[model samples]
Target: MKQVPLHRLFMVLLVLLASASCREQSRVPSQAEITAISLKRGQLITCGSSDKKFGTVQFDVSCSPEAQTDFNLALSLLHSFEYDEAEKVFAGIIDENPACAMAYWGVAMANFHPLWTPPSEPELKKGVQALRIAQSIKNKSPREADYVAAIAAFYTDWEQADHYTRCGRFEKAMEALHTTYPADKEATIFYALALNAAAKPTDKQFSKQKMAGQLLAALYPNEPNHPGIIHYTIHTYDYPELAALALPAARKYAAVAPGSAHALHMPSHIFTRLGLWEEDIKSNLASVASAQCYAQEAGLKGHWDEELHGMDYLMYAYLQRGDNDRASAQLAYLQGIKKVEPQNFKVAYAFASIPARYVLENKDWQAAAQLKSRPNFPWKEFPWQQAIIHFTRLLGAVHLGNTAAATAEMQALQANHDDLLRQKDTYKASQVAVQLRASEAWIKLQAGHPQEALVLMTQAADMEDSTEKHPVTPAEVLPARELLGDMLLQLKKPQQALEAYEANLKRHPNRFNGLYGAARAAELAADGTKAAYYYQQLLRVAGAAKSVRAEINAAQNFILAHRSPQS
Candidate 1:
């Protein structure tokens, strides 16, 4: 009221407003307070409940009290890669509370699917729309705004940026968000996920993946029931050297979220890596059933993509264990499915690889030659997937001594490989290169170019050894090192073949062909003790399985002939 300086009066008013803001911040609701408010609205909010069975994730956001529980549930589903279900839950929250900005963030997150294929054009459009909506909603806190911006990084200029560039941008954004809030568990977990998503498949040292693994491992003890922590822990360590480290998470993830189809299936990644076929089989069987149930509940006309993925694992595990009867059943099941609900890269890989794997693993060359690509799939969009069929045919032709057929199949495969290279998919193109070189080496051997064939095959094996398998594949359709062993065996160099087979077994243990090849190599090398040891191991692994595979019989006869008469 006095004639005070105007600027000083303004500064005093600002201080008073700041003090009032601090008082409001101090009155922010606790979890219990929110729960009581939620209860008053007849909403029972709890983690680990049947309706929210994914895992425990507490993401505090400025939303309606009733929307908080659903937001957490949706975030948990996003962690499990249950994108469709998570989107539905997030949409429900938006419907209940139109100002819930985090629900829109969840919607955008669901559409992106960082660890899977890049979003389709429609999905990208939907995500961009959702992000714009979340940004428009002014009720979100600063942290919520940061979360929205982090995902917005992915949607930014998506049409102009490649998948890798977009992922890198998103990862950089998440890293910045985590750095800004080191105490926020959600930011830390998401940062780890982004790291793994941006990891290069060809990085021999696996720097990014290992770093992500360490981050997740640090979080594991406190968040053992956390779906993202355990799920991402498995993903980050999904390599030959690191897989053993993930065994604990792999063993625990399925039990932690048995309702999630992806969780039920993810443990098999480690089991498959360590050659734990029985456990892989069990994990995938549960996943397949869960996926089937999900498809039914969602009113899908065909099997869910997850079911196809699980069946591929089931086929691989069954073949590894010499359970041909069950393996054939899986093949039949796949052959019957004309379509999958979401025809993504994972589904495409499964569709092409399952049949190819069955023939290659069983060494059914005739069937391989006759292997037809399933109809109704968008094969034109997936040339790398198309390469699978041609590669199978090339191998079959080489085995059957059909040089012309082999040459033709090789040409087709080379075209597919070129297409992949043109598409700038270097990792997959390198895989195709492995297939082409291995097939050409076999063709060289058929033409009596033994030394050239050996050099070429050895190069293929070394190149393949330098990289790790993509998550889409359980293993190479046929490991080139194993092929190197086979070629040496054919050329009457059993010792070198044994060395090759031994090297392959070190990486791909308990594979039926690898084990049988090693035993045969040892037998031909006149190493009876070693041969008996391998044969006995084979029998111990697959003796109970009902199969007429000649390798199994050979192992049985070898074991019987070497038996002690006294025993």
Candidate 2:
């Protein structure tokens, strides 16, 4: 492949990217209309693959023009989860206006992406420095002090507490700030987002997220072009049950500011949740292309981690459509990501998941069983990534009737789980535990221990039921209960399998494997009416993707032979 001349085409592509997506009506912010909803912070200078002004944010900050512009840029980056870029902007503000207390607040806020991951020890210290800078400046307004202090509360005793605890402190502080300035839109928006960041996956009532949604939803009409409101709102409803509510935001977010690679990719979170494969494919293609230019401009060689992240979403969308060839190509494209330093969470996830899904989605148990993590991958340095590969191997081995290998894989998974636990990484440790137990159950089932397998998998499912799936792949490598449903079907217990599948479908909703399995189970159980209903739904999403599944063809035949009123 010829190396693209990134620096030469940078400016030309920037203009094209911004125009290609976002519907920008807003402009550079002014303080006259402090509460004006039409403020456009994203008025950025785009270079091919890079944006001189990445975030199209509108700030309602009570600071000087220079400070406010910098603050707006910083907050816009934060909204897109571009913490490093946001913090840099914040640092520039501090240099430009040492007395700008809010710039410190911006710096602190930029250190953490509330919904994704916690700040590192170095990040926390950087946040602390920003706070100290704010404190030493005596000419700050009372409101500016509160803003800085709110973030300060988040970093207090950072090493002594856990990530969630710090997140809670930030939320508490934001609550106080919002209360103090009830009408301040920025305070209200930030507070709502902080609540969302601190939300737990099992909050079935989605209480905290619902609160964020209500705040964001109410503000949406007023701030139609506001990236934070639109982006955060999409996140607010990014779940299987609530995805429909987020469609408006998802449809609008990328178009509002396509310069940010993450902004280009954010909409797919909603699309993935709702099984909107076509939209996901469309959005990710543009996002990956946009990200590549920026990566190349920054001198990155093979895989741009950002581009790979978009590819992961794109691959899942293709897999849903049974486009095995596209998936094959996407995996081949991913192999080019050889350089290491920038291995982010998304990179780590795609590294394992792309291959794992390639085989697992086909129910190709033999391929999964023999899956290997390449010797070049630094397994110890990235045990979490290693854990994903092992989980797939365990699932494949047990499913393919290789009990000994499955048992070993399960043990390896447990060791990784323990390693995470030792590091106090509760969130990932929980996920590892779920995979570990699920693999063990599959191993037991392969060894003819049906009762034990069911119990073990049930327990794992119950645990996962209370939390959200990791936001890497579209969903879990098949939810454990869904796998149990598959196993039950293999045992010829269609009734039990149907029941298990229904329970899973309720939580996961329109997942391809779940929907297809439910249809097959229903047909086997002699319930042609329900079978037809599910088969039709599956066909709707499957579209025209090739590489046929025999069961899908069987479902199509059954549906055609006895079409129900609903079908």
Candidate 3:
């Protein structure tokens, strides 16, 4: 050792350094080590220290330098909606170190921010290029592979968005934001928006509008100043019930952002839905005033101006209050100003829908059908519109005694049944489908096709399960079961109907329909004790349901009259 020259020693040291680099490149860490390191630092790394007692240690480090840190910071900012700040930080890191693949990955994450005004084609192309570079430097990390899988699933062109989001490439903490966590409000909101943006256009495609509403409900559970959410909700009035569902959140948002036109508009819409006519009008007026003030303060006016916000609200308020004349006047005013731009199919459709709604409310089915059939019906933009149009046509056909036409409409509905099930846009669609099937089954029963009717009802029940992934609500499933029970009773299958109704009642004890159905089946079967017991249960559960209360009274009187005294 002492005899070795200085240059020779330096050469030996260089050989050792090169060898170490090569070894590190080939090293692969065990799963336990990876998990331990990830838990400790909340970051994904390429290698983990080996356990001494382990027979073999396979460690391969694949992570690009500084990738973990960049991904974590980008994820934090993305979640917080700090897009500009995150972009700036990621951009700076990429500039400093091009091979720092995580920095390029952050660029993809930053590009997904909803609030960021979308880049031009050239800009997006550049961003895609950066992501490809990051993807090329990838290692054998499972987290990285997961990220790549997600990117492949989502952005087909970039493919890295999925990878970054999935692989713990972005903040490891944000892994909780996946679609698997249905109840996580923040994740739900993000996923809904992502899907809404990504969904394809087709004849019976997924409902972007519905997904948007679900996200809005999750994000602003009791508040509503979210402009994007409010806009989508108002535009898709295909589900009026959603307005009621969103009211509490909308009111809360309005309370916080008193100056927000959307905040005021949301409550106005909700009040109208709740049939609080006076409050609806007042809220709309306030929204209109605020819009005008905002316009003046912003020094904006006329059709192209960003501040011409309240015309839609004004129109809706007038129509809701039965002041059609005023609504027409406001519509004319909106036409004249051209100050506010109609962003989507919602604006023009609103005008057409108003007339259709009037006819429906007046029970003028033929008139409603005519309006719905018009070219400007906005069927493509709103699924509910299509559903309503068909529903109206069905009603008209039924009224006119056109059996063939009514049957044809029913057939068409069944064909598009999957679309109806997938809808979360409005609870009404789901309820309507159930009722429609039940009605169709009743018609079949009347025609001496009781078995066919039962089959149809069963199909309807299955559809309910297909759409809603969560635990089936007793309220929803019970009605369908009770309807089936009635059909079975009509078919002279009282024992089967009794069993069905009893099962339904077990799940929904307080349901008047379930109790009544069971009672009817028992009575028809000549089971006096069982009939009496079911009738008594019906009365006890009727509570405040007006129809059920009346039925229960009638049944109790009949039972008393029919009772016989025995020695």
Q: Choose the strongest candidate by TM-score.
A: 1
How close is every model to the real structure, measured as TM-score? 0.90, 0.87, 0.38
Candidate 3 lDDT, 1-567, residue by residue in tens: 569999999999999998887665444433342223111111211011112010111112244455445544444344333344456556555444544545555555555543222333444554555555555544335444444444323334433343223222222223334544554443444454555333322213346546656666555534334433443344333223344555554455344434345445555545544444455556666756655654454344533221233454444444433354565566555445443332333333343344444454334657644544445334544444354455555545655556676677666555444454564333335655764776586557655676787888777655543442111110231246666776687678999999878865543343445666788888888887888887776554433222323456766875786677861
Clashes found in each candidate (C-alpha, N, C closer than 3 A): 0, 9, 19
Q: lDDT for each of the candidates?
A: 0.85, 0.76, 0.48
Instruction: Return the TM-score for candidate 3, rounded to 2 decimals.
Output: 0.38
For residue 540, what is the lDDT in candidate 3?
Answer: 48
User: Candidate 1 or 3, higher lDDT?
Assistant: 1
- Compared with the true structure, the alpha-carbon lDDT of candidate 1 equals 0.85
On a 0 to 100 scale, what is the lDDT of residue 322 in model 2? 72
What is model 1's C-alpha RMSD?
A: 5.8
* Per-residue lDDT of candidate 2, residues 475-501 (tens digit): 786688898898789889998999999
Error of 1 at 82 (Å): 0.1
